[model samples]
Target: MKNTICPKCGNETQELYDGRCKDCFFENFKLAELPLVLHAKICATCGARFNKNKWANTGSIEDIVFNTIEDALFIHDRAEDIEIYFEPRQLSPHMYRVKVEINASVMGMPLHQKLKTEVRITREACDACSRISGGYFEAIIQIRATNRQPSPEEIQKCMRITNEVLERMHKKGDRFAFISNSAEDKDGLDIYVGSTNASRHICKEIESYLGGSFSESPTLFGRKEGKDVYRNTFSMRLPEFSAGDIIELRDRVIEVRKFGKNVTGTDLLNGSRFLAPPDEVKGATLIAKRSTAANAVLVAIENNELMVLDPDTFETVTIKKPVLLSAKAGDEIAVVKTSHGLIALPEEVSRKNNL
Candidate 1:
């Protein structure tokens, strides 16, 4: 027996089970079950999520998983991992987005700078030829060749190198997106995506020339503001048709008490005090409806809408009228008019969901 900590639940494992014990191991394994369509940058040491900051020097992968602190890394381990990383990372549980950089080429060619892969070519760039020639030009070329936090001079050189490639390609009848690390000059060392039709041709040519680079991420370079990357915040929307989910079914309001007319909506808990559009709520499957005597089951909803239990049984009313409950089980449900439809939601997921 050995002791290991479940990184997420922070529970102690009594045996070595997939780096965790029996009860705690399931969470990690479950992550593998879920489609991995999301990629995120995290701290190599503390496992804290990374954004709003630049990172480099991630450690190499072992098979597909990277489990080393000395290495800054990301691991995509599944079928969906090929297209886009898939994992529900709650920027806020209800709202999520995935970010990743492309790896390898369409031909499946490997590019390793460390190994000096001949497939990875580095040509002396000449952007000056492009800028001076107006339309027909060769881009500039510069390099830091030294490692001291990639100086402004180094980045400048990288940008010039990028331009040179663009220039050479343009002359050769190519129009691709300009991707870069970052910039010294906000105006110059930036990214640019070409026209749709021409872009396809140019991108192909560039891919054929330079496969991949550790210093560059085309995805970041092609970052489309306000749309692809946004301060977007949204909640789940329940289905309105075919009824897989509905609102006001298991709607139980906790911590409600008599309050003055001036009491703000915040007085209600267990759910939103102020109602949002029906589309903004989570859905749950409608289970068997029954009736029972339960006091304090009524609550106010929307504008002047009262959710009250039937006086006789106080349970979810079965439309077309049928009774289903065992008296020995003390099973009693609240009966009320269903305004929203029902959606089948997983038990575990629904529990974790707040929306």
Candidate 2:
């Protein structure tokens, strides 16, 4: 093999690769090749990179660019092994200088190659960010009470639910799930959402967590893609009465236990439980909170009623004893006075030294 001749260039060489001399082999075989300058599309708002004609949101810009270069490499068949390394240097906010080193083995010979190239990142807004910046929204949520203004605490709960839903949806790759705007008006609180599906999801969460019902109303806004586009407005009405509210209905004093499809409460007059729809509880008047009740002395007990002396007025009045309370005469207990009559409420008592 010391006297081999190459037929293509008539060159003499001891070693040959694919019938090519060492000089020819070196010229023909290439470990990898890339352009001097490459362009990358990037989102100005989200920092997303477009690679291989697709937008990727998973990695950093450097990782994305390195991967793109690795995929664009052309490896020759004669190269038995190939390794690539990148030394990236920032040239500007939108430009970078990447030093690429290619190490390979061809014909059992080691080879090293180096190239310095430029990566230009062109900034453009992504679809989600663009829509967000443009104030694009699909539905509006109106948080209101059935017959009165919503409390601040209720409004805060609604906002928290919306934020939580948006965060969960964003984690699942729905970037368009977000709240665009929020406003508090005299009537109620209004929240604008980016996606209709997200809007519906938020309403469901509100109902499930805060106890409410909502209705949807659609209005024709404009035309899109040669079709009429409509925007939805969800009117969510929360129950007027909340838990811990003492209400008077049908000559009965009841303490609201829970608010759901059916409003549940315990009858403060007789310790009986009652369940009614939200509409039926709407007519019930709020008398006082159980927390506002004062301690009264049980004067006497008779067949289904008891005499209690009001601690505030020091006036003796006969009220029905709640079946759940088993206090005897001369015992101190909590009692509330309502429009219909005075009622004994269930209280938690801890005796110390029989005081």
Candidate 3:
């Protein structure tokens, strides 16, 4: 090893960095640099931060302040084994004083630098929040039922599904996944959504949970930035019958257990499992619900027949017994009265009564 003389300071040293001794090189070298003041844009309603020319849901106000400071911090390229720490003091709700400490080594020499900056938070509406507040919507979902009005329970379930899907989409970086408005009409429920893609997802989830199908149609709403803008309307039709509904089709009486693309139920006439497509049961009249059945007195039982006293009229009537019937003589049994005659319900219906 040979000793070298620094040209700038005239000092003797074993090594020279950038034509200067270690002491002279370090005298003017800047280990770290940061602006005295920084600004952070945040949404007043959703608490989202604006950074890198975009808005994001980046945690709390303190985290946003720290991130803003870190993005603006500049460290020397020659520094190695660097470590940084931040100490923040909240001066007010919209202002913060942060002190940054940097520790590193340059040319095998330990170096430390402390910098201070003030972060001013400007609260305003982001793009998504602005659009939401302006009642902007890209799609509308109409929840309806086939051959009947949507029940309150069904409507509520649909709304729940919509919210869940929108929330998931938002977390996945879809800022426009939000509900703008919702209205209840005599026909059904109408939900206005911000994103058409999110609306499609909501409809699909609703159909999976409930039994139904949906169709989408786009209407030219206006022009934006020299481009045509179209808004979509999703029409969802729920299944005609829900669970526990007793329907009569042609010559068969069926108790619906589930209804989707395919209808599943137990035939009340013979207690056999019934499965058919929606079109097969078209015009099936909803005769009654298992919940509305009345208790009748069981008098006797013959081969494949049950003798029961009618609930309305105390006349002993003999009806064809269902295979699932488990009632004994002198006991009460569930029976539904129709235009045909008094009919004994299956054991599943009786168990529902206890529940």
Candidate 4:
């Protein structure tokens, strides 16, 4: 090993970096370099920040300013184990002053420097925010029932699904996945979505969970890129008869257990499982809700009928016993009085449903 002397300072030292001793090297080295001012593109509506040509969630103004300055900084490549400290102050609504401390080691020597800079928050709506502000939407979701109006709870469920889908899409960097507006109508709910694909996804989710079907229709709205642009409308039809609804179909009292592409239920009169098409269920007449069915006392079970005492009327009546009924004589059971006659419910269904 040989000792080297710094050419500029003429000092003799063994620790030399870039043909200069540690002291001279550090003296001439730039600890940190940054632009005089940094610009931050922030959305005024959603408070999202634009970074690297993308809109992203950001922290407070001070934190954003500090981060912007730190990102734009260029530390010397020779500096090792570099650390930065930022002390920021709000100078005005649009300007921020930040004092930065740079600490690092250059060739086994400690180097420290402080730099002051300013950050200007340029308020401009990001792409998504701008579209939202202008009431822009690419698709509309119309949730309607097959035969009757949807219940409020059902509509709320659809809205919740929409929010969950939007949140997931947003996290995946789909900034256009947003709901512009939602309106409750006489038939169902209308949800305006910011993206056509998102609208389709929302409709699928609603159908999968809520048991329905949806179709898409596109209409020419305008032209883009020298071509015609079209927007979509997703019409989602929910089942008219939901679970726990009693309906008269095929001259039999049926209880709807589930409804989707195929309607599944149990015949309340004969206690036989039933499966039919959505159209058949739609044509069926809604008699009463399973929620309104009353409890009854099973006193006697004949070959094909059972004598049950109605809890409300306190009268014993002979009703058809279902094959699926598990209750023995003298056990309490659910009974629904239909227009034709009284029907005894199976014990399994009684335990399964709250009613």
**The best candidate in terms of TM-score:** 3
After superposition on all CA atoms, what RMSD does each candidate show versus the true structure? Answer: 30.2, 6.9, 3.4, 4.6
**TM-score: the better of candidates 3 and 4:** 3
Best-performing candidate as measured by lDDT: 3
For every model shown, what is its TM-score relative to the native structure? 0.15, 0.70, 0.87, 0.78
Per residue, candidate 3 scores C-alpha lDDT tens digits across 25-69 of 888899999999999999999999999999998888999999999
* Candidate 3 residue-pair clash tally: 0
**How big is the RMSD of model 4?**
4.6
TM-score of 3: 0.87
lDDT of 2 by residue, 55-104 (tens): 55646888767865676667667777788889998889788889999888
Error of 1 at 344 (Å): 74
Ranking, TM-score, top scorer first: 3, 4, 2, 1
Query: lDDT value for candidate 3?
Result: 0.90
For model 1, the superposed segments whose C-alpha errors exceed 4 Å read: 1-148, 176-190, 193-355
lDDT (CA) per prediction:
0.29, 0.80, 0.90, 0.84
Ranking by lDDT: 3, 4, 2, 1
Task: Provide the clash count, candidate 4.
Answer: 0
Give the Å shift of residue 321 in candidate 4: 4.8
Clashes of each: 32, 0, 0, 0
